[model samples]
Target chain A: DVKVTQSSRYLVKRTGEKVFLECVQDMDHENMFWYRQDPGLGLRLIYFSYDVKMKEKGDIPEGYSVSREKKERFSLILESASTNQTSMYLCASSGRGLLDTEAFFGQGTRLTVV
Target chain B: TQLLEQSPQFLSIQEGENLTVYCNSSSVFSSLQWYRQEPGEGPVLLVTVVTGGEVKKLKRLTFQFGDARKDSSLHITAAQPGDTGLYLCAGHSSGTYKYIFGTGTRLKVLA
Candidate 1:
């Protein structure tokens, strides 16, 4: 089975603090994504990377940035955490192919900004 | 803008009941996918429908794609506690790489 691993399951950080959420995929997927899940808004993509050092802005990318230094690892960075930034963060990976190919996801990271 | 809208934002029913969740869009898509997400975990792919007017069944769950490629639906039979979760639909335009997700449907099944 393909696996996507997130670095942290739960995290708490103060406002104005810099935060990093890490993700790694073992399947050598060419696409990586970061999404924030909220109660009614569902999952909104923050950023996505199709290749090393390449990133694309998703629908909601104002408060987030991403890094894909390695093929298997993609990182989401919060320049300065704020209360509104607290949410369940999800990481997913998928092989390069047609758009419908299912994307495998990590367990998820719940971040709380105080 | 490409958008997928899911209907019946919330649903609660007793065990053994049948229910259907709908995902609709105004724009055409190449394919659509259904996913179920538990409270603390990321969403898992339930099924993917690519062909127009195609229907796929996974045990008690039935998924169908619209002929216009602009809509889809998921029907669940014999609802159980194990089936309770948030259901999401995602789709991509004909040549796009990113998948746009729906608003989601939260279902609760009582025993």
Candidate 2:
């Protein structure tokens, strides 16, 4: 069975504090993505990495950054957490082909920046 | 930016009712996928439709992709309370791994 594990299921931080959400996929897929999901907004991509150390900004990457030091691990960073940044963050991985687009996702990390 | 929109943002019905959720977009997609997400969990891929005007059925759930590849729909027959979830559609444009989810439809089937 394929698996994508998120470091935390829930986190609460104060404004201006740095935050990290970690994810690891045992599937070893080349494509990993970070997304923020809110009610009615669905899942909006924040960043995606196709290879280790290679990352691309997604549509909503303004307030977030990502790190991919290893192929199986992807981390999402919030330089300074803010109230508006509170949302459910999700990690996903997919194979490296156009047609191999089936993404397996982690359970998700719900973050609250107060 | 490619955008996918789903209609009937919220729906509530009793068990055994049939319903359909629509996902529409101006941007054409090479393939489309449907996902179901329960509360507090990540969305899971239910099905992927690649061909134009293609139809796929999973149990009582029916999925359809438009011939233009710009839209899709999911129909559930005799929905049970277990069918309650947030349904999302993802569109992957020509030769890209940039598939994005639709606005989403929240469905509630009461028993």
Candidate 3:
């Protein structure tokens, strides 16, 4: 079975603090993504990495960034955490091809910025 | 504008009741997927519909993709308590790796 492990389930941080949410997948997939889910906004993509050291900005990438140093790990970085950034962060991984491939998600990390 | 939108943002039904949730979009998609998410957990893929007008079944759940590939629906024959969760629809555009998720429908089933 494919497993995507998130480093943290809940986090509380002060304003202007830099936050790091880590994710690791054992499926050896090439496509990894970071998404923030809000109550009525649903899941909005923050960033996506198609290969190691490659990243692309998604819809709501204003205050977030991501790092993909290795094939199995992807990290979401909050440069300067703000109260508005408080939301559930999700990490997902999928195969290289888009067709017939389903993205698997890890247990989400709920961040609360005060 | 929201690329994908789901109707009936919240639904509560008795056990053994049948229900259907709709996900609609104006833009065409290469593929659409349905997911169920429990509280404090990430969403899990329930079904993926690729071809237009295609239907797939998983136990009591049935998923259908619209003929234009811009809409989809999920119908539960007889919902159980275990079926309570947030249902989300995600669409992937052609030549892109990113998926645009729908607003989501929160379903609650009571026994």
The best candidate in terms of DockQ: 1
DockQ of each: 0.72, 0.68, 0.70
Clashing pairs in 1: none
A54-86: candidate 1 lDDT, tens digit per residue? 999998899789999999999999999999999
Tell me how candidate 1 scores on lDDT: 0.92
TM-score of each: 0.96, 0.96, 0.95
> Chain B alone, model 3: TM-score?
0.97
What CAPRI class is candidate 1? medium
- In Å, residue A90's CA in model 2 sits off its true spot by 0.7
**Per-model C-alpha lDDT, please?**
0.92, 0.91, 0.93
Question: Candidate 1, what DockQ?
Answer: 0.72
* Cα lDDT tens digits for candidate 2, B16-91: 9999999999988888989999999998899999999999999999999999989999999999999999998998
Q: List model 3 lDDT by residue over A1-114, tens digit each.
A: 889999999999999999999999998999999999988788888999999999999988998889999999999999999999999999999887645357889999999999
Instruction: Go through the candidates in order and give the C-alpha RMSD of each one to the true structure.
Output: 1.2, 1.2, 1.4
Model 2 ranges with Cα > 4 A deviation = none
| Number of the candidate with higher lDDT, 1 or 3 | 3
Instruction: Write down the TM-score for model 2.
Output: 0.96
What DockQ number belongs to candidate 3?
Answer: 0.70
Cα lDDT tens digits, model 3, B1-111, are 538999989999999999999999999988899999999999999988999999999999999999999999999999999999999999987677778888999999999
